[model samples]
Target: MSAHSQHNLPPSLTGKGATLALDGHDLVRMTEEHGSPLFVFSERRLRGNARALRDAAKGGHARARIFFASKACSNLHVIKALREEGLNIEVNSGGELWKALSAGFAPGEIVFNGVAKSVPEIELALGHGIQSINVDSAFELSRIAQVAAGMGKRARVTLRLVPGIGGGATAGIQTGSEKSKFGMGQAELKEALATAKANAAHLDVAGMHLHIGSQVLDLPDFLESVRFTAEQAKAIGGELGKPLQHLNLGGGYPINYVHHNPGANAGREFDYTPYTATQSAAAMLGEVAGAAAKALGPDAEIFFEPGRAVVADCALLLSRIENVKRRGALQWLFLDAGYNLLIDAAAVRWYYHMVNASRIDAAPDTEFRMVGPLCDSADCYFDVEGEYLWADLQATLTGVAGVTPEILAALKAKVVRLPETRSLPAATGPGDTIALLDTGAYTLEEMFQYCGRQRAKAVMIGTDDRIVTLRDRDRPEDLLDAAERQGIVRTVAAE
Candidate 1:
């Protein structure tokens, strides 16, 4: 009779008695053997998400190609799985490019994108002959030209533009507005293209890249950006003395994390709906193509970079309950997986639907305040950035009535909200594994060790039901400093 028993659970999870299995593999056994606080990814779901995005983008434009955002989840195995589904790789840095190459992503199938690319990173990207490098700023474009010319290779690139559109549930994730640190404005875009044309011997301007934002729910935002891109692309080839070859629209299609579908929060047990993208990828892509088909024509191919939408729902974080206690009219549950492992919990207050995997079918009738393992008070599992709570935390902490922008950001980044009361089962306790749903994106790569905890294992349910380790759980030695790995270990004798 509980909504938590059904809607919040992912498609790959099915209940059998008290056990919840993922694709016929027991989750409890998985946590036991592989260790607690593990990342369990569904290969089936990864492929399905990729195919769905590809289908969506190609619906209107058959030449549409998808580039999986590597910053979402850079696990080599996961990257390869997504690539097999017809998605190419788009990396944000040199490390990601290295991993993409190791995963066997062809040079032409990869794209390098970042604001502050180092000389060595540019050299590496050019040397590898990746598909295209998105130039974030004019300075970066000049730097790329130098690197490419020195390497005796033509650096293929696209101009990333700020189109005055915003996205994401929070301001932090919104990337396309004028306030954003990424991409060039219209004037800058024209200048950058002219610069690339003048230096055609080193840098080649492929097309323009526009991303209104990440976690976008509305289709109109995308359509506006697409039209703007086509308009820009119309002017690009003329300036560069050649036709535009591709248009890269960076991906920000949101995934509904809390409710089964976006905007279904009314009857839901929890009040969390990250954002909504009402149209399917194919539907949205169709509309964009329809809007831009005239200006872009057939020659300029379309490219989509989908990071969160492709991988965010393919995996979930599995952690065991470590302890339970009462704290001032609230029940506090300590989780082995906390903000350290799930950075979004504390970073931008990104919510992930939680279900007790050990009792996945049990009725949820209790509320608990989830706490992480860190010593910092700011390390709790929830953040309160609402209007009233901001006032309350500010007034209570510093006794200030009105606040400044600097103080507001600081408090928002580090404030104790209501701690997100979850209606988990009454029997949820220590050793029971808690499944955080739709965590396949940005969780693993952003994870860190704050409370001296080593990073967790990323285990995949391979084809034919085989359990393969995509990434190893960090051993104590892995997290140790030079002194500890040598001198400290030698000093501490085992009895």
Candidate 2:
């Protein structure tokens, strides 16, 4: 069977089919136990994704290691579960490093990567014996060497090279361009390797790393990077007269979201088939390793840092309908969750499938536009005033059935002017339950406490079918306490 068919999610998810089980419990019920606008993760889904990645990396010449890029979603419970599945951890900052440590990952089981590595942070990683540092630039490498020398320790490092290929479901996620402040160029990396060899006492240059981009739907792009990276490794090893121990291929694998949950409207279905093909990831990794083995002498281990692909489908963002507004013939769902929780809206704009968790079997009776409760005009995910891509263009031609042909022509003309604008034309009313499905990755980590609203609670449904709170809902007191601790407020200020 095709990978798409094996993992294709449907238009609606029943309580039994759902890993998190939306139908068995209501958002209101969860809110009572936890709070509103909660994030729910499924242990079953997390494990499944982990295994899928593991399976794809098997049968290759190189030993494939999968690391959960904890920057995507860093809840301690979620991190711990990934650790249990034997996935290594990838951290972008010291706080994330701490979280990975707290989640029971030893320093050697962690790979640290970032642009600005503070002196203390490098010292911390060296102190803890992290697996390797994916160095961003030559300057950072020198800093690591200096820090490691101070402690009389040798730090293992990997150089992250920007492959100049940027791709993702959204434009904002593409980070492989030369303009991006991510990794080092070829010239800089060569110089750094020479330096590492010259001073082998302070630094152990273990491997070459390359992350083309994130959320890449194109498999060939990744394959090309892998081939090129393997070649670079061969060349560097020849020039330095020593083979590197690891080849880190940073992850950009996309997940199958439809299998997780359909949209807020039960009637509308999302196409999830294109992404889940096992052969896609498998074939690409195999080809790359085959070439690398021939060139690099078959001894280096391959590492993959898959963040979004592992966790994106394992969680759902549950929000109650604070109010529903109807404008003309459109139905608008004003959800409690906004750009704060779903921060993807800050850059790439795409509609996450919203589903009526309360009414799973409801017919396709309503056509509507979904909106978030953020006060800013552009704060919501969808721009109602912008251009739209209507699945049924014929239905959009009519608004209340009295609109004339001339008006329809004008609207069509406007839509043509901005071809990429995607808007929802229909309005929805209040008191409905709406959900943003497959929001497990990057959503929670990017959350900001905007509008004085506290962060929402996060719940996880275990393999035992019981619900547990991953994080308690943030309260006003909690925010105030944090402020006081940060010296943003005085004790008398609260009084």
Candidate 2 lDDT for residue 407:
65
Measured on C-alpha atoms, candidate 2 has an lDDT of: 0.69
Supply the global lDDT for candidate 1: 0.78
Where model 2 places Cα greater than 4 Å from the true spot, the runs are 1-12, 15-20, 23-28, 257-297, 384-429, 481-495
lDDT of 1 at 469: 90
lDDT of 2 by residue, 1-495 (tens): 221122233322343322223524555456556757888877887776777667667555547787788988888988898888878899999999999999899887899999899999998899999999999998899888889989999999998887877766544566676777889888888778877877789998888888877767776777677777877887877877788899988887765543332322322332333333343444455555555556545568888888887888777887777776657865566778888888765445544655555433343245655667888765564543344444245485666577787766555543322112112212223544455678888887778788877787888878877887887777776756655766655655776
Clashes of each: 3, 17
Q: Write the per-residue lDDT of candidate 1 for residues 197-240, one digit (tens) a residue.
A: 77888988887898877788788888778878877776777766
